[model samples]
Target chain A: MDLSTLTYIVVGATFLLYIGIAIWARAGSTGEFYVAGKGVHPVANGMATAADWMSAASFISMAGLIAFNGYGASVFLMGWTGGYVLLAMLLAPYLRKFGKFTVPEFIGERFYSKGARLVAVICLILASVTYVIGQMKGIGVAFSRFLETSYEQGLFIGMGIVFIYAVLGGMKGITYTQIAQYIVLIFAYTIPAVFISLNITGNPLPQLGLIGTMADGSGISMMDKLDMVVTDLGFKEYSTQLMGSKLNMFVYTVSLMIGTAGLPHVIIRFFTVPKVADARSSAAWALVFIAILYTTAPAVGSMARLNLMNTIQTGPVGEATANLEYAKAPQWFYNWEKTGLLKYEDKNGDGRIQYYNDKNPEMAAKAEAFGWKGNEMTKVDRDIMVLANPEIAGLPNWVIAIVVAGGLAAALSTAAGLLLAIASAVSHDVIKGMINPDISEKGELMASRLSMVGAIALAGYFGLHPPGFAAGTVAIAFGLAASSIFPVLMMGIFNKGMNRQGAIAGMIAGISVTMFYVFQEKGILFIPGTAEILQWEGYTKSWFMGISVNAFGAIGALVNFIVAIVVSKMTAPPPQHIQDLVEDIRVPKGAGAASAH
Target chain B: MDNNASKYWQANVRLVSILLVIWFVVSYGFGIILAEPLNAIKIGGVGLGFWFAQNGSIYVFLGLCFYYASQMNKLDKQFGVSED
Candidate 1:
């Protein structure tokens, strides 16, 4: 079968499989809807958590970011995975033992104040909604590229698939469907990686192939060869290039680490497991699964860059006729160009593609001697690097089709997970806990379903008409979770002295500081990440201690810890019953099954 | 009972603090702060520092999770806090 038809079949089969799982695991009660009836096995929950955690960005764009940034991109790999360590050791087991639904409920009950819960709910909704917009875009983009549909049509299809499973089954449906997604996405990701690894380094495992010798029999190492190839073309050495100063990389990694732990969707996944011990072990399993992709990412990145460089720089650098002739460019080049992600300009009218770091002052002489005008390839969307990997390596059509399925699986699984988080928080925390204290169980389920629909519609709208500052969403989302949610949760669990007043003050202060910094830098509080260039330039040198806005989250979290501690001391300690409640949650004994609000 | 609880809490906190120190050492310490010096030493065609940044820290984190799980299980049982 042709590639396009195969992609359709594979993608169709996966969507149908998700719907089938949703039907099989239809949620019947509020408890089932919110926490999958709290009966998910540890291993199964781990797989689901893995799928829910690795968004389309992880599956699609991370490798490309690494490809361009080189060693600097370590912030992502370490920061993202390190959060599991915090989750495993500090947060997951205790939260599971608390044995309730939704993060806000815990905050409210622990702090003995509804106001604290309200703050948590708003933060969760904002972070999750901002996050889901990115996922919606990923879903739309992946669908458009694979199914050959328009972006809107692809987005609607994705929304439909999520609606059937998520609205009907809730966490119950999402858990089983996510297991299927994990298997599909992991296979989709690793299969092409194995092929590419073998092609370049004669090794099937991308992890080992990354550090293995090149297959060209020069006996040179892959990293050594990559450094030589990139630098010869006037690019920085691949293995040593930093993202910015070391301080920025340090804070950026810390921000992402705590932020990952703080995310409401990830935290709630632990609530589905049967035992506190299961929560701890499940975190290990989730990381094991995530690391499979995270470790392979660097290998895929460096190897893809090598492949791209060799394809363009067909011969020795600084030599005439060294660049690939545009007329005779490979099929992969033409295929990607048709997608508009890869564009080549005939700079100097040479009818050849010269791709290098043109702005590098060091390379100007070499470019002038070779009569090169500039880097001819004006646009190479980083998103294309992973999607076009199989094509670039001349892999078979089946491998290419599976990558499309993998990208969609990543996007859809996370999208459903986030929408479910938003819906449950509103229904459980707002409607049942606050708005309608005597609301019937059936009525709340309906409310949750309605909220799910609304959340999906909102996400879809943003996806269709993404703001220009779409790139800044990640920073803001992670920053809010890190500064506001994470510190409060840790203090709540570990420090019995943490009072309602303290928790409330800390969240407000932390969230405010984070928002203030992001806004002051980006220049928009109402609609952040939409900063125009002129305003962005104005705040260029305002970073405190050379820390960029993206790296200020760790500082915000520190402020939260201090403010909460000081406020709690100034105020009364938590009441005796609240102290006993903290003590009770600290132990695993007498823990009940996961219950609804 | 309160005495046992306090001791158990102390042990748990101590374990977490120690493990976190190791976490910091591997990621921020070796991966970033000492990365320049560590890059002088390499394993199998890659710089140790860059490898730690991208690959080694992740593996270490997995190890930490499993270790903490086993240790916590022991602590729970030791403190008579294991779930039914």
Candidate 2:
């Protein structure tokens, strides 16, 4: 079959499977919509959680991030996975025992204040919306690459598919759909990786292939060979640190941890398990599922780096000196070239493409001696690295089709999860909890469906007009969650002395500070001239005492904690029953029959 | 007057402290502050510190959770607090 037909068949079939699951498992009641009736099996919940967690960020961008950044990007691997450990140990089981429909509901009830719940609703919306934009971009990239549509057109198509199932199925529909998505995505991600691994290192497992022998008989280390390639190209050694400061890395990692713990979509996954023990087990299982991707990413990165470098820069696998523009570039090159992600410039009057580091003019001199002007890969977008991998290695058409379907599965699954989270927070927490206290469960469910529609429209708008840097948008989302939601929930569950006033104040403070920092950096939103006064570019580079401003969420969280603690101390203590409520949550014995409130 | 309840709490705290230590060591310990010193060691052509940063800490975290869960289950039975 032709590439276009093959891709269309795979993508179309996957969408049908998702919509079919959404219809078959349509959420019947409020309970079913919110927490899948609190009866999801541990393994199934794990897979669903993994799908919810991985997002397009994990599937498409992670390997590209690692491939470009080398070892430093490991923070993403460690921080993201380490977050699950925190979730499993510190939050999930207790939150499950507290037995609420949403993270904010727990905060509001535990803190005994509507104000606190409202603050949580705000934070959840902000974090989720920003993160969804990244997913939308991923969908656009996948659609344009596979279907040959323009990016805007691709986003519209992506949004239309999400609306069908997400509006119809809700959380219950999403959970089962996510399970199937997890399977497709994992298969899509791994198959191409294995093929590349075999071709490059003669090892089928990309994880082991990462450290295996190079295709060349030279016996040099893979990292060493990689270091030599980029360095030869006038770039810093692959092992050398370039942009970010160490203090900044530490702060960034910590920020990610806090952000991961605070995300509404991930936290809500814990609510699906029947018992507190199951919740705990599910958290670990979620990590186990997530680890499959986390572990594979670096292997993919290393292998892609080696294969890319060997194919383009040097001899056919082993020789030191190879022609720069051999026209031998794989089909993946032409495919991605149409997307403008791959480009060529014949600098030294040589027809071959030279991809050396332009930063090092001295090395450019050596390459120029060989009639090469400079490096040719000017627009190699990172997003193309994963989706283009199979094509890069000349894999079969089905494998390429599967990657397209996989990318869609990842984006759609995460978008569905986020949309459900937004809808529930609106209906369950903001509306039912705040606006209409007398509203019945049935009415609230209706309100939820309405909210889902609204949220999808909003996401569609962003997808059409995506921000300049999609990844930067995701970082801000993380910062918002870190600063706002995580702190409020943590204090609510663990600290009995916290008052409603303090909880509300802290959340507002955290969210506001993080938003101010983000808005200040991106001046396009407001009148550009005043951006210097309101915005702080330095925050991204360094925060208080030289920490990355992304860590502002953690600091904002700290402010909330301190303010809440101090205010609670100055005021009257929490009532005796509330104190006892905290204790009850700690004990997991009667968790089986617990309320799914 | 329940010996088992006190015993359970004691065991729980002890196990939690131990696991937390391991967690902090592998993540904050090996990945950040001690990374340069630890990178001196190599495993399978990668630096030991880099391996820990990328994969080792996560494996340890998973192991830690299982250990904690099993021990907690044991403590629950011992303290007459097993889930019904």
Candidate 3:
């Protein structure tokens, strides 16, 4: 069968699996809806958390980002994974001990203020809604490419799938479904990587293949060869290129790490595990599962870039027969071209494609010498790099189809998790904790379902019009989480004196400053084109102290720490009972199951 | 609040601080701050620093978590606070 039909079959089967799991494990009560009855095994919760955390950005956009940015993308690799370390050590065990249904609920009760919970709820929604936009972007790109639907149509389909499983299943359904998704996404990610790695470096493991010798018998290493090839074509060396400033890279990594720890969806997964010990180990397990893809990604990225570059350049630069002829392009070229993601123009009427760094003035001068009008292979969308990898490596139809299913699984699972987080915060924290403290269990369940539907619809609307690309936009979500949520959560657990005034003030100050920096750079609430209104120049010139907006979260986090500390010192300490609550959550003894105050 | 409980919390805090320090050192230190110097020392044809950034630090993170879990288990038991 053709690729599209095969993709349709594979994707359809996965969707069916998700819906079936949703039906089997549908939430029947508030407990099931929120924390899955706190019955999840550590290993299972780990797998589900892995699926919940690795969104379309990781599966699709990250390798592309890595491929293009080179070593600097380590911020993502280390930042995203390193947070789990912090989570395992700092937050997970204590939060699990707290045994709450929602992150905001924990904050609300721990800080001894409904106002604090409301602040957390707002931060969670802002970050998560922004995050869903990135996933929606991924869904749109993936669906349009594989399913051959319009971007809008693809988003509608993605929304429909999420609606069915997430609204009905809640955390209970989403958990089981995500475990299956973890398997699908990890395999979909690794198989082609193994094949490509083997093809490139004679090593089956992409992690090893990255540093292994070239299969071309060039005698030089893969990294060395990449450095040589790309520099020959006027791009930076693959092994050591930084994003911009090293300071920006440093702050950026810190933001992502803290953000990863603070993400409400990820934290909630820890709540589902039965014990404090389980929370710790499940975090480890989540990292292990995630590391499988995270480690393979760089190899895929570097090797795919090598393949992509070689496909266009064909031979050494400055040679007459170097460029690939437009008419003689490979089938994968035509296939991706059909999606309008990869295209070429015969610049200078050479009937050949020149895909080089036209922005590099030195290469630009060289291209001018060669009578090239400009770089002709235009519109190589970074999101397509991983999705197109298997095909670019000439893997079989089944492999390509599996990648499609994997990308969707990654996107959909995380979207479901985020939507669940938003829905629970609305129903459990907002409605029950504040608005209707006496809400019936059945009423709460219904509210959860209704909010889940609303969340999906809202996410779908934002997905239809995203502010940034998949990965960069998702980084903003992390920044918000890092600056706002992470500091307060840490303070709540670690600092017993952290009162309601401190927690609330910290969240406001941290999130406001981070959002101020981001909005000033991107636009108000990322509406786009509004940055000019702020007289914003660009990152290179305007980034404060060489810190990009994504990197500004660390500064905001610092602000949060400082402000909360000052505010708490100025105000009264937390009550003795709240201090007692903190001391109780510190130990792993006599921890009951998930409970509401 | 009690001595034993306070000691357990203290031990947990120290462990987390130590592990977090290692985490920062591997990722930020070897990977970014001293990457250029570390790159001079090659590993399997790749720079040690680059490897740490892209690959090695992740392995370290995994080890840290598993180790923290095992050690925290020890602390819990020592403090007579294991969930069991």
Candidate 4:
């Protein structure tokens, strides 16, 4: 009946469903644990991949980021989804034909060098660990909001749920659970969007509603109205705002695209499907599923921004009733206020809430003339846009509950996927492949489970006390993956001349350069107060050639390509068998079934 | 490489090149580099550039995936390399 109770019921039900799937799909062998026994249908695998790929960032944070950032956020949408095309076309089918359990294994066998495999393992761990930290943050936030607990406690609970399914069923359980998660998250995401769209633009599809006529019969389109509303309040026009330098945006988009394709968690999902062709088709299907949310995001973002501004700035600036009185603020305002993410101070002793661009001196003068000292809403966390949307729009309690469940589903699914990637890289690639080559299948499975537990604990710790490097960490992770993993994998597949020396050198160069750039900007290993180069104040400019660290992956990747090619040419050619192995992976014939061992 | 296998691989490379060019054009070209020029042209309610960035490129990506898949399958069959 109440919001909390409804949220509890929905979130509790989803958790129970995940646990049930885990128990039912409990992996019996290494194959099942790692790749779901390679029996997953293409469509099902695609849905699973969509769930795996769309983390808390996509489900919870992306639309909120777009809401505030406007057109500049297109980098995220295009960058993230466009990578699937590269995956399907360049990597997935070939990797599927290779029939490997982990990415490192492919590198190990393809390059015919354990050292190259180890480099890949390190890169995979760094990127995946960084990614899991973001997921942990999402889980903590979603849990804190829905369960009304502290962020730390929410993180612990989220870690426990992931431990259950991931440790027990591995990829098999994660796959099925992710399918369920995809359904829950997509529905939760779209329902609020549809409602907002219809209410705002009289269009049912949010995508169309974003560009459709206003429901108020204002004759102007929704975009034009939103632009007028914000610009009228001294904010930039939503449709035309550039995020950063166009060069940075371009490079950022390229980094994210390659990073999405290179992520170990996403690439491994294709390994679960039945055939090479299935891998390609499944990537398409995954994008199709992801696109449903991606397309709706811009609509939800612009609409939510419009609604938010209207809520605070009710009319034209300088008008007597322009700002909403604190006493008359909506229930959603009070609700988010309790979380401390939304706060207001009665500056100028004003009884009303003034949400405006106080940083603009011109606007400040106008605000001063209206007896407003400064903006009262001191902190409005961008993350609250989606979570608070249903309540903001006066939707029923069930919709809010579904959103809570959806956010948790997204965080949990992606967390499980990342944990799996970490676990497999450690257990299969490190432990069995190198540490104890004679490890039994049973021993390996146990190691994988143990690694999952360890990975979850580490991720939870980072979530609780996110590093100073936490700002834009997800983009950094993407950069690392794009720079290090994607290039090597592409070279390994497409270039027969690629040898072990080249692959290893390229990975090291790419990851180290990307890390150096990122660490110089963010901090060393994201430890606070460790940045050698201050971003804005340093004598030497922080970025190189006007490129932000987040966008330097393309440069790092270029360096890798050049270094690898040069090194390979200097070194001996790969052994004849290794050349044949590359040739073997290029074709679809005689591709044996995924091994059960 | 055998003749059929080489032929199939060539065909695959050709398709990928074409699709990738389209991908580059839609996303990096219309979406970013030429966004200003393209924005001068309106679509539905948004600018053509914004539409390409936000919506059109994604649809094209989907089409490319399916097209690549089907074409590859046909090529695989022609080369007698379709997996059993």
TM-score for each model: 0.98, 0.94, 0.97, 0.97
Which parts of model 1 are misplaced by more than 4 Å? A526-538
DockQ score of candidate 1? 0.83
Cα displacement (angstroms), candidate 1, residue A90, comes to 1.1
* Least accurate 10 contiguous residues by lDDT in model 2 chain A: A316-325
Q: How do the candidates rank by DockQ, highest first?
A: 3, 1, 4, 2
Q: What is the DockQ of each candidate?
A: 0.83, 0.54, 0.88, 0.80
> In DockQ terms, which candidate is top?
3
lDDT of 3 by residue, A1-597 (tens): 998999999999999999889899988888888999999999999999999999988999899999999998989999999999989988999999988799998898898888888889999998898788888888887888778899999999989988988888899999999999999999999999999999989999999999899998888999998898899878888888997789989988999899999999999999998899999999999999999999999899999999999888889898879999988989889887877888778878978888888889999999898888888878898878998899889999999999999999999999999999999999998899888989998999999999998998888877775645444577788888999999999999999888999888899999888888877777776676876676534444335887888788899999999999999999999899999999999999999986765
Residue range B19-81, candidate 4, lDDT tens digits: 999999999999989988898888868888888888888989999999989998988898888
Model 3: residue A520 alpha-carbon error in angstroms: 1.6
CAPRI class of candidate 1: high
Clashing pairs in 4: none
Model 4 docking category: medium
Worst 10 residues of 4 chain A by lDDT: A533-542
What's the lDDT for all of these models?
Answer: 0.90, 0.78, 0.90, 0.89
* Clashes in predicted model 2: 11
Interface root-mean-square deviation (Å) of every model:
1.1, 2.1, 0.7, 0.9
